[model samples]
Every structure is written in structure tokens, then in C-alpha cells.
Target: MDKNLLGNNVIAQIGILVHDIEKTSQVYAEFFGMMKPEWSLTDAVDKAKTEYKSEPTEARAKLAFFDMGSLQLELIEPDEHPSTWREHLNEHGEGPHHIAFFIKGMEEKVKLLELNGMALTQKGEYTGGRYAYMDTFKELKVMVELLENDN
Candidate 1:
């Protein structure tokens, strides 16, 4: 039980799965008295290099972000592809998906989590960095997202 496996222990974001990004984003924005954030689609499969269960996948999702001070709230509407988001949405319906932590050393962090019995579920590259989704639901009751930025 090495708590140090996850350095800093700060949650950078919370991702929520949704059926409709447009409607959900508007509701959230109105509730907070802010403009609805623009939603964007994830990078194409070739660019993102997304994988699911260790197999290359063409899964992509629409994403919107709300900056909540130190933490970010992400809304995701996944296409009908075999992705973590889509799976969660189909199985559990629209709700919380993952809690993300901004981390360094992507490979090492992923290895550490895998060694600890948290299997890597999905991964992909974004514009400036990459992200990994770990199946930590059995232990943590929620999926864990590891984000490594190339800053």
C-alpha cells in the first residue's frame, strides 16, 4: 500500500459521462451563472492513438470542461465505440466516470498502478499530452484517470 505511488495526491479533474453534452453543459453553466463552455471532439484515432483493453480503437468522445478553480469538471459524450466512456455510459447510464490526477512519468505511473492490480483500461493522446484510464473501480469504487502533460 504505497500511497506515494500517486505523487501529490491532488485530483485535477472529475470526468462525468453524459448522453448529451449540449444540454448538460448548458444546465451546468446556467446553474453556475457562467457561459456554457464550448464542446469539442477528441482527436481522431490516428492522432490520438487511442487504445481499449490493449487493443487499438477508434473511439472518440465529445468533451467540455468547466474550470472550477483548482479542479476541473469535464463532461463527456462518447460515440458508439468501445471506449471507457461508452462502456460506462451503457452499463451505468450517464453519471460520474473518473477522477483524474495530473501526474508525471506516464509509463512509470501506469506500471506502478498495474503492478498494484489496477489494470489499464484505456489510453490516448490529446493535443499537448496523454491520458490513461485505470480500472480501479473494484478498490476505489470509481475509475481513475492518469493525465501526463508534455509541458
Candidate 2:
């Protein structure tokens, strides 16, 4: 098998889609014995800075992150917008949606994925970082999200 596109030995954050962030987060916190996570809305994502399938979009979602030692568990409550989160929930129901890896050389990585026939399904900017989701489910059985933190 060819090497993984996301690189080997890099920890990835597990992302899940939920119908209600508060309820799901509460359950996760209780199960993990961690403090309640602070959820953040994706409303601040400028529509002009987002795209879906290479087209402009106004997708949004509610996100909460819980640090679990070296990795994070991300809970996503998607709005009625046209985002990958919403699409995943609609297609797969409440469950794991994607695996995200923080990366450098984002443009190059994106290009490489594109060359390999993976299309970018979603992309947006939030705070100090930008993220792109590649539709790799057909081959990898899961979407791949690349996060670039400029901090």
C-alpha cells in the first residue's frame, strides 16, 4: 500500500457530528470525566471565505473541542447550512464524521490530493486557522480534514 497522504505517526483529532452539541458534549464530558467543553458557533465564518465543492457557500456549525491528552475530540453541531457536517449527519446519522490533521504546506497537500482525484468538499477560516475537508470517503471510507493553524 502507498503511504498515507496525511503522513504517518501524526495524531489526528476525531470529529463527530451531532444533532445537539450541548447534549452530546455533556454526555462526552460525563463519560470522559472531563469538564464541560465550551462550544463555539461558526457564525463568525465569513461566507466570502468559505467554499463547498469549489463553489462559494455560507455553511456554518456549532463546534466544541475537548483536549484528551495528546489528541482532541471535536463535537460538531451543524446548522441548516450547506456544510459537510450537515451533509454527514444527513447521510450517516449521528456518528464519527472525519479525522482531522493539523498540517503545514496546506496548498501543496491540497494539490496532491486533487491530483489523486480527491475533491475538496468544504473549506473555511476560523480565528487563527483555516481548514479544508477532502471527500476521501469513497477510497478511505472517511473524510480527511486538513487544519492549518497560523499561530
Candidate 3:
């Protein structure tokens, strides 16, 4: 069993995936008084088209991160057609996309998810950071991310 998944992990962040960033930024800034600082715009984005042929149109997402206290609030916007965010938006129109939790023993947790039943959707390295994806779709409908420690 994956004892590494102990719940000391805080709700480190919440991500919102959208279609327009500049507009949404204003909305959030006004509502939450969220400060948009320099060096907050993330240039690291990797995209791949979904394999669902039955799904309508082709879409992709661009990611940007914002700091809220010690945690980050990542905003993602689709670049074209109708991607995951678009599908979510079309079905429900822009809301909380995912909840990121910080945890210890990332690699062990990922391995345990694999052992239990979760499927790994993607894995990659970006901007000198290491990350992995585990699908929790059928039940949770969220991707569980295993992020390498910054230290």
C-alpha cells in the first residue's frame, strides 16, 4: 500500500483552465485583489492533441502560473478548437479545473497509483522541472501529479 499518500499534503493550489487569460486575470485581480507580479508568466507549455476521435474539434492548452501566498494558482487557456478545458467549459463553462496538493515521496506515490489502478496520462521534464501524470478519471475526474521537489 502507498503509505506515502498521507494527508499532510495541503491544498497547495487550485488551477483554473480557461479560453482567455488577460480577461480572466482582470476578473480575478478585481475580485480577489490578486497581485500579478513580474516573472509570473510561465513560458513552459507542452501540448499534445487528444486521441479521442469521437470528440469534436482539435484543441490545446497554454499554461501560466501565478503565486498566491506560498502556493500557486495556475491558469490554463485553450489555444484552438476544443480541448479538455473547452470540453469542460462547453459542458459547464469555466470553473475549478484541478486541485494540486503538495506531498512528500512523490515517486513512491506515483508508483503506488500505478500499482493500484490509475493510468499515467503523461510524463515530462520542463524548464528544469520534473513532473508526472496519473489518471484518476473515472472516479475523481482529476489528474494526480507527482512533482519532484524544488530542493
Candidate 4:
């Protein structure tokens, strides 16, 4: 327990990033009878194929957020382009990718992670959330994301 970092009051938002988002989401839908949460759907269609190039992308994703009473289940699928989903699938096949911890000292924590030798792939803000992606998997492997709700 990181206490002030990932405060104990925060809820768990479990994530599963599959190459085929729909197929994986279906599994949860069957088991828990979970449907997509309306307000949590976010798809990034502008992210580049490899890097954050200026070029447009068909790289899309459908994330279904399922309310599991205490903890929530987030199911993700990449649109076959530049993404953690694509990269993860290329190496490890389909599986649960990252566990996002809700933190308070995001900038400070990022600096600490870098100092400790964790590979930071990208560090930036999205909407109102401040996030840092670090490579914790084998190659350009799984990204351990620290998301701080700046709002």
C-alpha cells in the first residue's frame, strides 16, 4: 500500500487490453452479465501508427467499462495499429495488460520510477487525467500506467 500515492480510498479499475477488444469483452459479458458503461467509453482515433506522428490513424479502440460492485472491469481492443494492445498482442498474444493505480503525486512518482530504472514510454495528460506509461513487460512490452485524476 503506497498510502498517499495510491490512496486506500480509491476504487480499483482493472484493465484487460486484448488485440480483439470485442471478443475479450464478450467473455466478461457472459460470465458476469456485464454491459458497457455509458460514460466510460473512450476511443482514440488520432494516435499515430507507430509514434505520435502528425499522420491520421485508423487505430481505434473500444473500451467497455463494467461495474463489478466493488471493482470495475475495463476491456480494451486495439484497432490493429500503433497501440499497447497491438504491441502486447505481437509478443504475448491476448491477455490482461496493465493495472492502473490511482495516484496523487503523479509527477513526483514518475520521476521516482525513472530514477528506479523503469522504462517510461510516454508521460503526458489526457483530458483531465495525468498519466505515465512505463514498459514493465519484456520488450516494448506491457505498459504499467499510473493515472491520476487531476479533476
Candidate 5:
């Protein structure tokens, strides 16, 4: 396809699905000998404007982050509501979820991926940015997340 659809190939983060954030975060922290970061709930539907498979959804998730130099490790605990995270957890049972890249022009990036056969799965807003998950598992073996910070 087009060269550098993502503009840059640097991976900003790696996300993991977990059934229990508290227990999982503790395990990661102890294993890595790092302080466990506090986990927080994602924004509500209204604020997050979450959508699943192109439909609006109330799905939310608890998230914990650990900074690992150039890459951040994220752990996600999805609610019962349907979402990319929840689906992956239910189907795959808690493991790697997505590999994320920080990008500008989210709309264009999403469109490029969509044009290339990677359909958008889920998207939502956060405190300072927004995120979109792309259905890239079949080809890439993992979902792809686009992170756009409003800076």
C-alpha cells in the first residue's frame, strides 16, 4: 500500500487485557520491581463518546499504565458491556490486546487504515486524547490502536 500509513512506526504503547487489574497490576509491578501505578476508570459514555463496531456504546474499562522507557505498558479491564477490549478478553482470555502508536490526524489515519482493509473496531476519548482500535488481528496478529493527543 501507501508508504507509512501511520506516518511513523514507533510503537507508543502495548496494551494487555486482564480480568483483574488489581491483581494483575500487582503482579506486573512486583515482577518488574516498579511501583504499581494506580488504575483508573475510563470516561463515561457521554464524555468518552465510545463506539463499538461503528455503533455508540456504553462500554467502559479500567486502565492502568506503566511507563517502560520508550514504550508504555497498559493493562485494561473491560466492563461487561461490549467493546474491543471485552471482546478480546472473552474470546482470547486475557493477553495482548493491541499495539498503539501516537499519531496526528486521527481521521486521516483511520481512513487510511480502513481503505487498506483494517476496519475500525472501537474508539473513545480520554482526558487529553482519543484512541481508536483497528481490526488488524488477522493480518498483523494483534489489534492496532491509534492515539491522538489534543496538545
Candidate 6:
């Protein structure tokens, strides 16, 4: 079997696009006994550090993360600005958006995916690392997120 692209078999997170992160998170917490997630706004994201469709773009969203054992559940509520989250929500409504893999060789994996015809849809940096979202939805039925954390 080909080695896993992420180098690990574990899925880091399952991301969902929601119209209202607070409401959706509440539902998840109530239904699954998951703890309340800590919310973070995308306002701190540097637009100069982000790209969409290979072009500079501005996008923002409210995000919440809940740790579930070795994995995490990520909820995203897109802001009024145009973003991958907004695009997914508009096209498919609020639902499953992507599954993330925490990897080390981010650029190499991204290039590999591109060579395989998966387009890079979005990319940005945060506190500890950077992330890239690949447009693999057509083939995989869900976007693939690659995260490289500086640890």
C-alpha cells in the first residue's frame, strides 16, 4: 500500500461549515457531551499572508475547536467576506467541509497533491503554523487540509 500522505494514519480534525458557529457548537456539545469549544476570530489573519485560487484575497471566519481524543472537531462560521467557508456554504449549505491532516513536509505534500490535479483553494498562517486547503472535494468528496505546525 502507498504510504499515507500525512505520514500518519490519524485524522487531525473534521471541519464543518456552519451558519452559526455558536449555535452549531452548542448542539454538538449537547448531543455528544463535548466540551464548549474555544472561539477564535479570523480578524488577526494577515491578508498579505493569505491566498485563494492562486490570487491574493481576503476571507475571514469564526472558528471553534473541540478536542475529541486524538482528533478534533472544527466548526467554521464564515464572515461576510468571501472565503472558502463562504463558498462551500453557498454551494452546499452548512455541512461537512474538510478533513485535516497534520503533516511535516507541507510544501512537498501540497505539490504532490497539485501534481495529482488537486488545486490549492486557500492558504493562511496562524499562531504556530500555516495551513493550506486543497480542492479535492470533486474526487474525495471533501476538501483536504494540510497543516504544518512549528513545534
lDDT of each: 0.94, 0.84, 0.59, 0.60, 0.96, 0.85
Better of 2 and 4 by TM-score: 2
Give the per-residue lDDT of model 3 (tens digit) for 31-69.
Answer: 777664322332323332233223323444566667778
Q: Please name the candidate that would achieve the greatest lDDT relative to the true structure.
A: 5
- Candidate 4: tens digits of C-alpha lDDT, residues 59-127: 555677787787777777656666556666577776777766778788788667666566566444456
Q: Give candidate 5 misplaced runs (Cα > 4 Å).
A: none
34-139: candidate 5 lDDT, tens digit per residue: 9999999999999999999989999988999999999999999999999999889999999999999999999999999999999999998999999999999998
| Lowest lDDT block of 10, candidate 3 | 47-56
- How much does candidate 6 score in TM-score? 0.91
Sorted on lDDT, best first, the list reads 5, 1, 6, 2, 4, 3
| Global CA lDDT computed for model 3 | 0.59
lDDT of 1 by residue, 91-151 (tens): 9998899999999999999999999999999999999999999999999989999999999
What's the TM-score of each model vs. the native? Answer: 0.98, 0.92, 0.65, 0.70, 0.98, 0.91
Per-residue lDDT, model 4, residue 149, is 84
- Backbone clash pairs for candidate 1 read none
Candidate 4 Cα deviation (angstroms), residue 9:
10
Q: Could you tell me the C-alpha RMSD of candidate 4 in Å?
A: 4.8
Predicted candidate 1, C-alpha RMSD: 0.7
TM-score of model 4 vs. true structure:
0.70
- What's the lDDT for residue 70 in model 6? 90
Give the lowest summed-lDDT range of ten residues in model 6.
1-10
lDDT digits (tens) for residues 53-132 of candidate 2: 77767777888999988889999998887778888899999998888898887888888788888888888887788899
The local lDDT score (0 to 100) that residue 111 gets in candidate 6 is: 83
Query: Which regions in candidate 6 have their CA more than 4 angstroms from the true location?
Result: 1-3, 43-48
What TM value does model 3 have? 0.65
